[model samples]
Target: MDSPICLIENLNGTLSVNEQAIDYLMGLEQKIVVVAIVGLYRTGKSYLMNKLARSKTGFALGGTIQSKTKGIWMWRVDHPAKADRAIILLDTEGLGDVEKGDSKSDAWIFALSILLSSTLIYNSRGTIDNDAVEKLQPNRYVTELTELIKVKASSGASSADDEEGSGSQFVQFFPNFVWVVRDFTLQLELNGKDIDADQYLENSLKLKKGFGKNISDYNMTRDCIRNFFPTRKCFVFPFPATVEKMQLLDTLEDKQLSKKFSSTADTFCRFIYENSPVKTILGGKTLTGRMLGHLINTYVATINSGNVPCLENAILAMAELENQAALEDAFVMYKKEMEVVKALFPVDSSHLSENHLKSQTRSTHAFMERSLKDTDGKYSAILAGKIKEYANNLFEENQDASEKKCKALLDKLSATMDHGVKEGTYSTPGGYELYCDHHDTLMARYRAEPNKGVKAEEVLEQFLKEKSAESSSILQADIKLTENEKHIQAEKNKTSQMAQEKAALDERH
Candidate 1:
């Protein structure tokens, strides 16, 4: 899209999906690499998102303390590194906004970001110290995640048991975690030894030994980050411009920004473009933008109903919707391909059968490309049955077409012969020889005609049988023929009729 749109709107603590955004997502067929950013209000989250999108004007970047982006805003851009994939940039409403006065809503937003993204960027200003860690502690966002999302639908077990099991599985579904410390001024060193940004982040997340309320609180957030995310990365950005120019950061040219800041931004974008994986479910079924749209609707509906969204239930629901779409797509492709062969009606049986097999194969491949979680192959079986039925109908139509065309050709060719027989033109003294010669010439002309279809011989046999009585009468009236020659002619006619009957039988088989 040229610009971003609000994907989810949060108004007075109520969240609703935006139909326009959902429709846009539904139209996309490429696999998505979703990267979502979340942090406190006015943390330059939107600015980073715009940079990632490779556009300065796509995501709204506000200079004031007030959060400019409300709810979740989505921008879709072509992936720089992967030709077959697209990148979806989500700029969530800032967390911990005092004006909102709704921590519950913030928690949901946080949870949704984690649920939807393939890469989660936790943007924060200043250093990664105890206060920053505390904001991410169990008392704030990390611990509440277990309460906000469920791995499965409820059983008869207790809530505590369910939470325990769900916590262990978070890493299986959670996105890769990235910590972005904006306007970082401190040296990257610990105990007089210089370290990289990643090592510095690791040192900051280190758990303090011993047990106490403070230590436990400190360790909880660190442990949650380590356990829930399969991978973690860190990036530190120096101040981009002077205070006077900071408010106009989005408007400034790249040359106006600090060299270090611009270089770091480039590095960060490169890392994201190169490393972020396509969104996938538990079975490693990659999610296209259309599937992601369904996922958003499923989660939001569950949240609106006051129930925690279950991963398993959402996947099942999405599978049903996507599988039906896949089936229709495959069937449409099959019909489209068959239409080309249908135009050439009355084709040879082997030719028609060969085209049918090829179309069926292409349709099956189309279905397999989009189908997911079809462990029982139920959809595949249904597609096969539908294609088979369509093939049978086409074969019957071919037979009907062949019959019509062959019958029309025979009627046109025999019109003159029928008129001559009715006028007694073949009943004279030497007329029997003339009649035999004319019939043989007509038979040769009929056999020489092209494109008579598979029932050619059968139709000819029927026409010959219908004329046998007329031929016998003509032979008896001929006065010039001897008795022995007439008997021989009768026997030859009988043999010819038998031979025609056998040929018609072979064609049918």
Candidate 2:
């Protein structure tokens, strides 16, 4: 009901919200196919799309000469015949409208539609003729495609085989070009025999040109469409209703309208439905919901930069951008989870604190690694791997910071524990149990991450080595001091006894 996402601004030439569109597309979980219509302004293109969509109120149908579809408009719908596919219907701004003359902008809209569609209908209002055919496939339009390939090739945007001006590049995206002649005044029967639309189209194609200088260009242009287009389909619809009837359908209500307007173009609708491929892309890829913006940006950027759009080059661009998008999404997810892990670190500045930091760092890095490795669509393995490389760097960087925290914690704990042992508060080995208790508490928390537990144990062992060295040195000095004190006490006792004995003997004499 609300207008579909406008891919391009018809007059301003701005492409909008492509990333949102691309994301929406990838989430569809269904294969995407496209059907599009392109023609001169006021040729019933919008109404045709409305019919194709099997809806009456959705796509706007203009009553006046002004074009209703100002830019490229798209509607996503379920494929009529296939359950596994989604069909994207595109209604383009008409070319050669009175409001906007046939300018370079018109050419871009025309070319872009052709590039994006799987089944492209070229709508015209009159009988098919040399002039009609020529107008439909203008020399400029054909040459513009070639010229674009030229620019793409010259700019080295395309590879060797698919260079600009090469048939391979331009022809790769050529849709099944259907020439739908809306009003046929001429006879379908020639000399009392039935003639199919294809036969009639061939007659127009085979018509010889009148004498004119440089008419060769016209001939060549026609021939190019005939020769290079992968497939050609032709259909001629009898004039649907009178001009008065058509205008009433535009200007008046059903009660205000004639019954002639109510006559449905049933056979025409059926033809379109039946002719529509089950999956328009069939075996080839063109229109998919996610790739829409990439395709538009690829061409729009090239055209806006005053260059030409090439198919393979566009594909390459899509690959790079989509990969980058996935990488960015993964980082966002990783950072959010890392924040949660960081909050799990111990608050107190104690022996257990270093283990918390180590565990947190391990958790953060594991979160990132898992995010980087998980991908959909095979997403440029090289670029995805580059992101993995970045995660590895983060791991190393966090380890360095956590290791510093661990060493500082150990040094501070060593001083406090050492004082307790020397001051007769505990036995020398008594503090060992307390320190090991702290280590065990944090180590148990990291059991899910076994490497983290191992790392914490190593840090504890290193701290013990420093503490053991200081304790062993002090204990050895205490042993020597105690032995000397005992020997001096024994000698003093002997000296006192000898002095007492000598005094007694002298008194007796």
Candidate 3:
């Protein structure tokens, strides 16, 4: 069983900087979707998180409400219903802790939760009312957090998200918000109609203003909630257990806690595991283990330095880094593949063949293309576009390498041409048979390569011309030998007739 990595301690504004933590997150082979909890302090937020994580003793459920969670804690656990993905449980410090004394900290906590989570569970005690919605003034902090967190934006646009043209850029980072109400003792029927939680929320949001409040930043707290979480959902849980009853238990698995709240908790957990999709950050990446450390650093550094985090920009920075790393890895593998292709060529010319080399090169190239496309990750269109460019460069690099090797083989053939010709091995009806055989071999070897250097055509033409000239010289020498032998035979026949006449005269005497 794998454990969770404490990504950040907000109390001191320190992220977990250890490589072990970084490696553990990076090592996750599954897609990650985060489910985070945030509401008023001691609202059983950590305990609920334990249920989701399926851990009896994790995330430290605070008994006395001095705020158990300081900054943010994340644990990677297998999704109960998803075999292909994992859930990153983000347990946040609760809001409205007076001893903390800073409303700004509360705002930062919410911002961080929204930034990191896919499905944010807004856990609160008692019935859902105007006050609960008012406390979560999502519309109020658009300008404040950008400066407080100090994230380096994608465009490097110094202007905030509220700056006229940046709205779309900023809005892409909002989370899917789920408002989970606890201990709701009110009736579902209103005026002879049965209303579910969604209808109840819509009716509550229908009013533009709440009693005694002008809705500070936006039209009203209700409007802000509606606008902020466009893809919103609501869950109402019966009082899981009394605060006094919960404090004494060691874990959610305790018989008393389970007996009272098991059914409601089971339903909530089922919704999370079955319904939540893998959350993508900035449309380019999921909040995976590999990227967790960098995000933590960005958030912690921005908040600690008193710079409001502009998440859109921070995401841009992370994606650029992620894409670069992915490309470099692909590039290395591409080179190794070419190395294998080069080895397929025979070391000496004895086993040289043309078509096989071409076939192998084409196969290797096709494999490279497919592999590069698979590297198209979270930032699909943009990262894939960049990968295409890198792949082109790789294709050219491999082609150039093939041409170099082909020229080297041709050079070896040229050196041996003089020796083979001098031995008259090239003179025959089928002139230069050895050279022709090797030529076919050379052509086959580079059949899959482009003619970038020392083209096969140019080498073949020069070789044939040289072989023809050598054969012509051999033919002229044979002609001279025949003419000289005929002249010698004529002289020998005349000398033989003279000798026969002398022998006849001697016999008559």
* Candidate 3: stretches off by over 4 Å: 13-30, 97-103, 129-172, 183-219, 241-245, 248-255, 258-260, 281-296, 326-341, 345-477
Poorest stretch of ten by lDDT in candidate 2: 445-454
Question: 187-221 in candidate 2: lDDT tens per residue?
Answer: 78767899988777766666256757567755655
TM-score of 2: 0.60
- Candidate 2: C-alpha RMSD after superposition: 9.0
Local error of candidate 2 at residue 276 (angstroms): 6.4
Considering only N, C-alpha and C atoms within 3 Å, which residue pairs clash in candidate 1? none
- Candidate 3 lDDT, 219-295, residue by residue in tens: 44554455556777777777656757767555444556644357767777888887776877654555566665567
Error of 2 at 129 (Å): 3.5
- Models, CA RMSD each: 11.2, 9.0, 7.7
- Candidate 1, 11-94: lDDT as tens digits: 988899999999999999898999999988888999999999898788888888788988999999999889999999999999
Point to the candidate with the largest TM-score. Answer: 1
Q: Residue 490's C-alpha lDDT in candidate 1?
A: 91
Q: After superposition, how far is residue 371 of candidate 2 from its true place, in Å?
A: 18
